[model samples]
Target: MATMEYNVFVGSETGLLKAANCAEEKWNNLNTLEDVKKDNEICCMCWGSSQQEKVYFAQRNQLIKVYNILSGEICEEIELNAGEGKFKNIAVFDQQILTALDSGIVNLWNNKGESELEIKTGDKLSCMRQNFFKRNLVATGGKENPLKLWDINKPTEPIFTSKNVPHDWLNLRVPIHVMSIGFIPKSEKIVTGTGYHQVRVYDPSTYQRRPVLNVTFDEYPITALTVCPNGNQVIVGNTQGNMTKIDLRKGNVACRYKGFAGGIKDLQCHPTLPYVASCSLDRFLRIHHMDLKHIMHKFYMKSRLNCLLLSKKWPTIDDEGGSPTDVSKEKIDDMSDALWDKLPVLGSKEQLPSGKMQKTKKRKLATKELPKQKMKKSVC
Candidate 1:
């Protein structure tokens, strides 16, 4: 049996791991329904290896499963012993696995699955993301919890801690509910999406710990965000299913993407391609081109999706698994070819054996003349 090569991997709230082939517009459930349980619900997912040959997903029951992409099997399962609440995110750095829970506990496990270090950042943690350029660094923030950058090596104190913005014109303190966090590539700047419908950019290199730029989207809270490869813009989605691209330089909305029905749970951009993948509570996984106005592909998943990982190895003709072909075109072409082969070819001047070409005479009709209207014409 040949396994399908998937470019998009989605985790559902009902404990189903789905793999989607964007080129073919088809999806498959990696795990069966029998393996699904309430406690096994997937909360977050990340690539287990640099080559993306494996997947690492954390569940609600504090269990982490390593899925092998080539074999299509769960090769390893590691249960997290430290941490309260559900796992929020998982990251891998230098062969070490890091897991963060909503209780604000980040545990570092070695290759043997032994807990080596644990850092208690804070409570009600909503998001934790690893820096792409610096693997040892991570950023965390949540409801009432300010953004903090931590170095796993030190683990003693946060290297950078963000301060809340100043009070509004009404003298009321600004609320802090960071739903998603993303690090801008090639720079120390970090972008965060808040539950207060704000997209903020924090610069650690600055003297002040407050966000250097702030922009608001829709009325609802921003649920997910992903930084573009250009490092100058960020795409954010809210609970109202509205996604917008914000320019960090001018702090303005650049573009808005449509075709979502419910709250967006997660957003991930392709590492090199000009495409982005998103999963939502609407039970659909959609891929949109960064330069186009319409969506590229949309798949209907059976269960509500939580998080999705976009593989860097996009499907091509030379990939291990076969490439997706247009079945409808192949079938239609084959039928037309067969029909044309069986049909008889006729000569231009050929005639039937019973008779040659015959000509028929034209018929003439008598003309009728009416009384002339000279008097009426003169009056006109």
Candidate 2:
């Protein structure tokens, strides 16, 4: 039997896209695609619906491009709805493609690139998500906007709306700024990451609009969130470079991993592994094991990273039961210890030798006078 393989596709700040066949020990970066230029920013990306071989990428200019990962070919290109606005998320299923715009409008497009339906969410729309189990159900939220669920079939009204929590101790109404949203798997609830540094879960099956679960994290805004495979926890990243695992069942911080130097832009978990990957404004991509607080690999990507897509498919190992891909040898050869030693260390202090004092030397001009220049001959 041929083993299933999945490749990871990444989008950068300059719209540079890359694919990699990942393994437990090493991975290989595939050739770059000329379709995504180095001048535009990537808004979001996701695997295509109906097939895992294709992926769709949205840009800052409202242009969407589809690519075949295995063949590295351009499958199709479609323009978003008229009136330029920042691109949001794309949810692909069967013959339909749903795109969310920053203007709080969700557009449904057919395979032939025709707009079929449009849903008006609200203003300041920061995030939107299509239900994982129920394709027709979608969630939307943003600044000062409560969480809402809508049915794609009935574009007129939302099925449910979340009620804001009671005022704070000072009686000031709390604000809403949901930066990211996703549907909970194997359940009827949804999770959201907010600008208020909160991770909230909402269940619409009940009549109450208040969140079923609410937990506060760092003081900085939570920019991105992804559900763990177990469906009982979520990995959340904040603008203050804090990435933590929050247990949904217990409503407490599970583990706090380090490695983010700049603010995080996106966070994604491995398809069926215990690894987590992140891209950020620091122009670096970092991967770490969920159980380990240290980094596994860190790469300087030359451009700020906005979003990343990890394919569900992975390579089939050999009959010997070991993966063929190994980067250890190449990684060791690629390392330059001498080059690094010659470079200046940032944020580090110069240390003097132990139990030794060095005297400073000043340069002095020569005490002996030099010979003067001879006069030139004037006449013959």
Candidate 3:
């Protein structure tokens, strides 16, 4: 039996929890009813903290709720309302959180829930990200054709901006809807994910919109984009459940691995390993090793998975059972017996915790394994 390498962060309309080590990962159910009712909806977006103590989650109600994962309690909830509409995304910095709202305003707040500053974007901010090197600077893209860079210190408007740079070789041939803007790890070069499954890597210094790669898929929207930890591979997952790793240096596909049954809603890459996690409306959390090119584990959830995150520091649950591959027929049968054998341990029917619920002999569990293996291969 090996220790589970991944711990899934599950968030549904009702609540959220960290589902841990099991053949089928089970929810620990950390969110209480009161918390869900207060926020209206469970987090619309959730990000795993680089900091060990916190898990960042946001609700549709325009509230950014930060949780202390170790204690399973809310640490801070910031009501983010700039002027109008709702916030679509939130990114955390060293000591502040940057929230991109529907009104094209990015609000900055500290851990104590106080507004530190606000960056006003002239266009609806569909997507945004902090610079990889400079924390004060941020990049945004959306309804506007140009990708704008803002400085928090200025606090009034963008310090520098670039617009409609021709997408000659980079092939940026679509609307900016749901596009993503990110800077190359340590370089001044920046990259954007066009809604049309094309990735444009831009050299900010030269304002060149070079098509790094044009990733084609069926009709599925590009749901999520992440850069590899090594900063050489660009991993993009589309709504069609296709995860492709492209080598930035060679501008070629490294390999493709598919696991999510439905369109991917979110994609997260590990900080230290070649592993990534993706969630979809299919209600399953899937783990894949980018290097191994195989499905590592699959865990079912109660509702549509809106977000998926991976961090080297998030806590995990320990189990005695073997890893997903090592499970044997005999072990499963033994588990089935143990599930029933524990019933007699109850002194009497009246001694049951529910008491009124009558006790009946537990039936033997089913022996069918899921057909997900075939499904995983089809998309790959």
Winning model by TM-score: 1
Model 1 spans with C-alpha error above 4 angstroms = 316-380
Candidate 3 off by > 4 Å: 1-6, 15-24, 34-39, 42-49, 165-174, 207-219, 314-380
lDDT of each: 0.87, 0.76, 0.65
Model 2 per-residue lDDT tens digits across residues 148-207: 999998889999989998899999988888898877788888899999898999888888
Prediction-by-prediction clash tally: 0, 4, 2
Against the true structure, what is each candidate's TM-score?
0.83, 0.78, 0.71
Give the C-alpha lDDT of model 1. Answer: 0.87
RMSD of candidate 3 to true structure, Å: 14.6
The number of the candidate with the highest lDDT is 1
State the TM-score for model 3.
Answer: 0.71
Clashing residue pairs in candidate 1, if any?
A: none
lDDT of 3 at 277: 80
Q: How do the residues 154-234 of candidate 3 rate in per-residue lDDT, one tens digit apiece?
A: 867675565554555778654555466656776776666666676666665663444434445335556677887777777
